[model samples]
Target: MNKDIRNLSDRIEAVFPKMVQLRREFHQAPELSFHEEKTPARVAEILQALGLKVRTKVGGRGVVAVLEGGKPGRTVALRADMDALPIQDEKVCDYRSKVPGVMHACGHDGHTAALLGVAEILAGMREDIAGRFVLLFQHAEELVPGGAQEMIADNALDGVDAIYGVHLWTPFPYGVVGLRAGTLMAAADSFRIEVIGKGGHGGLPHKTTDAIVIASHLIVNLQSIISRQVDPLQSGVISVGHINGGQAFNVIAERCTIEGTVRSFDQEVRQFIKQQMERVIEQTCQMYGAQFELKYGWGYPPVVNDSSETTRMAAMARRIVGDDNVWEIPPLMTGEDFSYYLQKVPGCFAMVGAGNEEKGFIYPHHHPHFDFDERVMKTAAELLIRSGLGYLSADSPEVTVGNLYR
Candidate 1:
């Protein structure tokens, strides 16, 4: 590794314990979605102490901190999601959620702490940098369509040249970071199908067209859209998450509801799946003599990384953690709101390893018992710093808007 990068790693290691403390504090006081009032206030106070210009409530509890460098160059952004899930805490740690029904089951506590750690380090090394550093503390990540879109609408990415974000993944082992050049995460879109039919006695089978029967047919046909309509190589998922029909067995309900999500990495595939879903729902309802209504909800776009930015950041990560610590993992079906920022500006989102077997902290995201090893806090922070600095220092633009659209 390079000397400067090694020195930065050592510096982050020295401050690792403080980052753990910050993470624990956040873990104990978890907040949900747009209601992250206390969380963003605490973050703003910390960033202000670090000598950065902090702005609060950018887009409903979203915080953006600007740290100007000694010299003028491009602007770069580093982001962390600050919202917690609605699950009750099941872990017996000292920092268990004090909120009755809210928990940091997705490791967002670690994400916030890691970004704060970067702010501290960059504040101290302001002279070494050549451009502005924008630290984004985003809210409502778990919500569909995400807080990122709101943040962008508020001109959070106006002057930003590039951005970087990370998720603390417990599936990978400690000391290993996973990344991909493009389409690191899939686009998550939701659909709801409501079928209306005549209500009649269950004994009179021929008297009414059953909505429950029509909903069942719609579910099966929706599954076939991915298998028969979409290309097998281009991945997509259509799962029926909820089905509600008649309340009692004796009565055929007048209405039935079917709701599910669609996930895909490619935009074309996403559109195809949506079109096929509507076609199947409409045709099946017609065959059963029922009225059908479909509501397709759009979520975050796919997180497609800029190759140049990812290559540069990966090299920096290998320097901070080691060549053996970095892995080129395949794209995931999970969605991230950070994809919105990447859609506006060129950026990359990487994963930080926070799994530790010795402490039994290996649960996947959103699980009730999910927790992460606090030791990885420093590593995640250092990677963000390195990626931001490296991208700002690069001669050419990491990614252009035209390239990203393509």
Candidate 2:
């Protein structure tokens, strides 16, 4: 680490207590997606205290704070998701969520607190830095289609040069930061299959075509798309999360509905999976003498990192966290709404390790017992601050918008 970054790291360590307090306060009163009314107000107050120009309701409870530096240069963005999931809290901590059926199971509270901490640190060093820093507290990350697209619609990234986002992942060990040059996260799409067949007495199997049997066959065949169709090197997942059919066991159901999600890193593979899925459902239902309807709802796109931006940010992260703490992990099959922002601007979304076995904070995200190690909050904050500063100081390059849909 260089002298400048070492000093910033020390400053971040000094603010550890404040970061913990902020995260605890947010954890106690969690809010759901697109309904973060009080969350934006609280985050705005913190940014206001740091003397940054704040804009609220950019995209329905999203807050953007622009902090101008002492010198003139390009603008950079640092983003943190502000919404929590609708999961019941099971942790037995004093700071456990007070809101029922809503909790920060995905560590969004820690993300918000880390960004606020970065805002505070950057505000103090404004005189020594160049260009502007935009701190984005986004809402509705867990919601399909994401709040990031809404923020772009509101022109949040209009003048931004580069953007950076981070997620606190439990899969990585504590004190380590993970990054990848491309395809950091997968695209998520949902599908529903409805099988229609004749209904009759359960005892008379020959009298009616069993929709339940047809649905079962379709579900099993759907798994072959990943193993047999897609290349082994390409990552894809087809998971049937829910199934609904007849209520009574004695009666043959007229219709059976199956719902699941499809995930993939490559766009071509994602498209191929969807196409093969339709074929599988149609052929399987026909074989069972049943009619089928397939509905595929588009979700977030794959998060592809810009090579130059990711490489530069990784170097800065190594400087802040040291070489031993920096890691280049393989891309995850998980999906992110931040992919929307990367589509509009050249950016990178990396992961910060928040798991610590000693503190019993090793649960995966979205789990009821999931909790983040508050000590890692400062690390995330410093990484955001340093990355923003570095990007702003670096040369401003032009970004080309290719055929994103292809």
Q: How does each model score on lDDT?
A: 0.86, 0.86
Q: How well does candidate 1 score on lDDT at residue 343?
A: 81
Tens-digit per-residue lDDT, 281-364, candidate 2? 989988888998888998999899998778776776776678777788888878899998898889888898989998888899
Candidate 1 Cα misplacement greater than 4 A, ranges: 1-5, 200-208, 249-251, 395-406
Return the lDDT, model 2, position 198: 88
Q: What TM-score fits each model?
A: 0.90, 0.92
Quality of model 1 by C-alpha lDDT:
0.86
The root-mean-square deviation over C-alpha atoms between each candidate and the true structure, in angstroms, is 3.9, 4.4
